[model samples]
Target: MRAIMGLDPVGAITRSVEAFLVALLMVFAVACEQAKLPNLLLISLDTVRADHCSAYGYGRSTTPVLEALSAEGIVCDAAYSVSPITAPSHATLFTGLMPQTHGLRVNGERLSDFGLTLAERLTAAGYQTAGVAGSFVLNRTFGLDRGFEFWDDYFPAEGSKHPSSEWMGHEVPAGFDRRADQTTEIAADFLRDSRDPDRPFFLFVHYFEPHGPYVPPDRWRKDFPCDQGSSELESMVSAYDAGLAFTDDEVGRLLKVLDEMGSTEDTIVIVTADHGEGLMTHGAMAHGQHLYDEAVRIPLMFRWPNRLAEGRKLAPAVSLADLAPTILELLGINEGAQEMDGRSFAPWLLSPSVEGVTFPVFMFRGKVRRAVVEKRWIEGERFGVLDGQWKFLTSESEEDELFDLEADPKERMNLASSYPQEVERLELLLNPWVRMKSPTDGSGITLSLEERQILEALGYGF
Candidate 1:
C-alpha cells in the first residue's frame, strides 16, 4: 500500500489496531468491575418511630443495634414514609412510587401489578431474591412477593395455641403475624443455607413489632417497667419501647448471620421502617389515622463498608419512595429510575458534604371512620405536602392546617389561619400531587374471610 504523508500505511494501521485493543480491554475491565454487585440486606422494622430509637437520640437504649449500624453507616435524619399504613408505605418503598400510583391505599389492600418492585429489579439484574415477612399483611397473597424467589409468609393456624407470655394479652391473632425472633430465625436460615453461594442476593427481612398492642417478650418488657398506677397509655408506651428493644436484638442476630457467612463487608445493609407509630401524638393510639411526624417519620440507615462513608448523617428529608431508585442507582442500574417518583440520594452519600438540601415529601392518608383533624373529629381524605420548613395539611371536610416544622417539630400549632399566604403557597404544591391518577383503579384483590378476620384483628378493619 502507498504511504500517506510520507508515513508507512502498514505502521499506521498497526498502531491504530493496538490503540483500539487497549480501549476495548479498558472497557472490558470496567464492565467486569461493575458486574461485581454487592449483596443487599434490607431490614424493615414495622411501626418503629424514628424518635424512639436510641440512634435517633431517644433517652432509652431502645435500638442499640441501630445505633451501632449508624456509627458505621449513613443515617438519614429526616426520612418519612409516603403513607403511614403498612401496605401503602411498603409499596412505595419497594416500587419508588407513591401510594396513589402504586394502588395500595391501606393495610388490607393488595399491591397492584402495574409497578416493578426493588426485588424484581434486583432479580432481573442477576441477584437471588428472598423475603421473610413478619406479618400476614405482607403475605404473598398481597402481591408484595412478586420477585422473591423464596417468600416466607407462613404463619400458624388461627386455632393454634400459644403461651400467654407470647401473646401478652394484646390479642394478636394467632396466624396473623410472627414475632421478631421467629422472623429473624427464618431470615438467618435463609442466609445460612437456602441462598445460593455463587450469586449475589437481595434479602428482605421484615420485623413486625411495636405495631399495636405492644407485646414485648417478658425479658424485654422487664427492662421498661411502668409505675404501679400508671395510666393505660403510659403502660402501653413502656411496652412499645420494650418491643423496640426486642426487635433490635433480633436484628443483631440477623446481622450476626451475615457476619458468619463472611458477607458483611460485601453486602449493603439498610435498616429502616415501613412507617412510624402514632404513639398518642395526635390523640391516636395507633397509626393510619394521621400524617403527624410520629406516624410518618421513620429511621433510615445504610451501611456498606469502604463503599459508602461511615458515620455520616444527611440532613435533608427523603421519602420511602426514594429507596428503590437509590438502591438501583447504587448497583449501577439506571434503566427505569428516571420514571420513579423518588430521586436517588447516592450522589449525596458519595459527596463529602451537601448543604441546604430539602426534598418536598408528599403524604396521603385515606379517610378513616374517625380521624383527628384540626384537633376535632372528621372523616375525609387528608393530603399533606412538606417543602422545607413549612408543612401544610388539607382535608376534604376540614380547614387547612399549616405548621412551621423547623420552629415546632411537634406540629402543635396550626399557622394556616395566621399565615394564610403560606397556606396558599403550600396548597399549590399539594393539590397537583393529590390529583394524580393511580396506575390501577384500586386494590383489585378481594380478601378471603380469614384474611379479613386477620386484618381486623390487626386493627385494619374494612
Candidate 2:
C-alpha cells in the first residue's frame, strides 16, 4: 500500500474482481451442462400389444395418452420382447441379457445377480433408483430388485389375498397385485416426495391393468364395442381395451406429475411393455405361450423433448434387451459395465437411422423352444427363423411349417413341404440357441401353492 510501486491499486482490484466473475461463470456453466443430462422415467405396461395401441394404428383408441406421448417421442414400429411372460422379459429389460445368459427362463424364477442391471450402474453414478412393480411376478423375491434403493413391491394394506377360487388350493402367497391407479399413486408420490431436486433419478413404474382378468372400471368400459356381449372372446377383447384405456390414463397422470416436478422437459421417458397379450390370437388368452407378433411385439416409445425429434417412427427391429445399455450410454456412465448381450441403440435414438446394423434378437422359453428373429418376426410351436419373406418353423408336436410373411400375415398357409431347404437352413441357425440351457434348471423350483395358483391364473400350465 506504500505507493504500491507507483501503480494504481484501483486497476489491480478491478482486474481481480474480473477474474473471480469469470471463474464463477464457468462454475455456473458446468452446473447447467449437468442439468441437461435429464432424469429417466421408465413406464412398463404389462401384457400390452403393439397393434392394440392407437399409436400403432388400431381403430380403437386403446392408448390415446400413449399416442399423444408417441407424437412427442420416437416410436419403434416393430419392437420385440424376449419372453411372452413378465419376469423373464423384465429381467431382459433390466439386465440387457437374454434368457439364456441371465438363466431365468421361467416364471417364479429369480433373476440371477450375475449380470449388472441398469439401476446398479446409475445408482453408482449418484442417481436415486426406485421401482414400483404392479404385479407380484416382479416382486423382490425374484431378485429383480438387486439395484433399486427403494423397491416398492409390497402388497396393498389389505394384504396378499388369493385372487379367486382358481387359486384357493395352492399354497403360494396370495400375491393379488394392486390396480393401475394404486401403482400410479405410488409412482407419483415417489416423484413428488422422495427425489432430491438437484440429483438425477431413475424410476420404473409398471402397470398391470391389461395383463389378465381384464376387469376395467365402469368409467373405462365403453371405449370398446363388442358385437356380441355374451361371447367370451369378444368380451375379453373389449375388457382388454378398456384396461388399456385405464392404464393410459394412469400414464398421463404420471406425466403430469413429472411436469409438476419441473422435470417433464428434462426427463427421458420410455413407454413400453414387458410383453403382449394373446387375446385369442393364437388360441391363448394371456401371455406365456407362443412367440407370435401379438404375444411378443410391444409398443416402444422414447421421449426426450429437447434432445429427440418429435413424431419420428423407426422401422428397424429392436428388442427390449437394448434398454439398459441405451440408458447407460445416453447418460455417459457405461464405463466398467459388464459385456451386455444387446448393443446400445443410442445412436439410432439421436439420429434418424443407423445403417448396416441388423441386431439379432433371440427368444428362449423352457428347454425346448428357441427362436432367432431378425429382419422379420416369425414364431411357431418350437423353433422358427424368418429370412426376408420366408418363415420356417420346426417343432416336435407340430409339423415343420413355412410361410411367406409378406403374403400371409395371418400365417394361414403352411409352405414347409414346399420349401424344405429353407426349413433346414433356418433350423440350422436356431439349433444353437435352442440347445443353450438355462444356467439353473427352473423346472424344480418348488412354488408355494399361492405362487403356483397365480401362475396358473396367468395361463401358465405349471
Candidate 3:
C-alpha cells in the first residue's frame, strides 16, 4: 500500500523528525560557540616608543619578550596615539574615540562619565573586568575606572621613603607611580587567584616605566651602561632603554603566569604603549610637548594563537582609538561601536591581503604652560594629520608644515610650501574633526591638591 502511493506517511514523518533534530543540533552548536568568550589581557607599556623596541627593529634588545610574542602574533608597524599625553591617550584607547570626543585632552584631565569604556562593554557582556594601573594618573578619581570590577591604583602615602637603590638615586614622591614589576605582580595575582576561572575575564595591566626621570634597576643600568664621556642625553637614553628592558622582563613574567594558568592559548594578549617619550627628539626632553613621530607612534601587537594570523606585520597607520572597536569586533560584540570615532581594523587582521590599506591618523597637542613655551619646547596648540605618505601639521601660533613621511621619515624637511594642494586636501579632513564638539563633558571635574601635586611630579603641571 505504501509503494502504491509512492510515499508512506510513517516514513515521511520520520524523515521530517530527523531533519528537525539535525537543525536543532546545528543551532545548539552555534550557541555553544557563541557562549565561549576568550579572556583578554591588555598590557599598556607607558612611554615606550615603537622604534626603541627590539620587535620594531631597534638595535638593542630592549624588548626581547615583545619580539618573541611578535613571532606568533600580528604587529602593527605604524600605530599612533591620538594624544601624546597619558590620560588622553588612554582615554582614547578605552573609549574608541579621539581625545577631542572623549573630552580628556591632557594629563590630569578626567574622562567624562558619559562615554562607555571597553571594560564597561565587556562587563555588560558577562566578562569579569579588572584593572591595575601603574600611575596615579589613572586613579579612579580620574574616571578611567568606571567599568572595572576591581581597580588597583594603590600607591604609598605621600612622604613614604624608599631606598635610593630602588629608584636609582632619584627622589620619587610616594603615591605618584609604581614600578612595572609591582604592577605585574598584582596583575598576575589577579589572573591566578582572584578571577573566577570559569568565567572569561578582561585584565588590564599598565606599566609606567621608561617615562621621565629615567630610573632603571642597578642590574639594567649596568646592562646599558653609558660611557664616562657620554652626554647627558646619551646617559638618559641608556637609562631609558634599561627601563624598557626591565618592563619587558615584567611583561614576560605576567605572560608566564597566564601560561601557568593554562589560559595562554585561549586568551587574547594585546601589548601597546600609551605614548612615546621624546628623548630629545625634536629638541623636547619628554612627551606632552610635541607631535613628532617619536612622541606619537606606539607599539601595537596582538597575539592569539590559531585564531589570528601569525608573524604578520601591517604597514597601515592605525590609531590607539581603534583598539576598543577592534577588540569588540574580534569578540563578536556589536552593540556600542557605532558611536566610536575609530574604525575597526579587525577586517585587516582576518584578511590575507592588506595592500592599498591606508587611513588618516589625526593627532592633537594642547598648549603647554607659558613656562614650557618660554623654554621653546612647543608653541601653542598643534594639530596634525597623517594620510598615506603626507603628514600635514598646522598651528595657530606656528607655521604650517608638511612632510612626505615615506621620503622624509624624520620630518626634518617641510614641504607645506611645495605641496599646497596636499595641505588643502588634508585640511579639509582635519578642520571638521577639530571643530566637532565633544559629546561627553569632563570640564566640571576639578583636580584636588594632592592630584595636582602628583601631576606636577609626572611633569604635567600648568
In candidate 1, stretches whose alpha carbon ends up further than 4 angstroms from where it belongs are: 1-31, 158-174, 371-375, 442-462
TM-score per candidate, in order?
A: 0.86, 0.84, 0.87
Model 2: runs farther than 4 Å from truth? 1-28, 31-36, 157-175, 228-230, 336-338, 353-356, 367-397, 438-462
Best candidate according to TM-score: 3
* Tens digit per residue, CA lDDT, model 3, 15-119: 999999999999999999877999999999999889999999999999999999999899999999888888888898898888767788877667887669999
Error of 2 at 239 (Å): 0.9
lDDT digits (tens) for residues 1-462 of candidate 2? 646578877888999999999999999999878755568999999999999998899988888888999899899987888878888899999988778668887777888877688888888888888999987778787899889999998655352323632222323355558788889999988998888776788999998887777778888887676785479888888899999989999999989998887788888999999988888776667776666678787999999987888998887677787778778887877563346666677888898756345544555544324433232233443554445566565656556667787798667688888878877766665565455444456533354565545434422232
Each prediction's RMSD over C-alphas, in Å, is 8.5, 8.4, 8.0
Q: Kindly indicate the candidate among 2 and 3 with the higher lDDT.
A: 3
- lDDT by residue (tens digit), candidate 1, 1-462: 356458797888999999999999999999987789999999999999999999999999999999999999999999998888888888888888878778778776778888688888889989999999888778776799988899998766542223232331233334777788888989999988898987899999998887776878899999999889999888999999999999999999999998998999999999999888877778878888888899899999999999888898989988888888889988889886866777787887778565456668889996578645437886767898888899888888766889999899999998988998898877766665566557588534354565555434422222
Residue 390 error for model 1, in Å?
Answer: 0.8
Q: After superposition, how far is residue 450 of candidate 3 from its true place, in Å?
A: 45
Task: Report how far residue 168 has shifted in candidate 1, in Å.
Answer: 23
190 Cα displacement, candidate 3 (Å)? 0.4
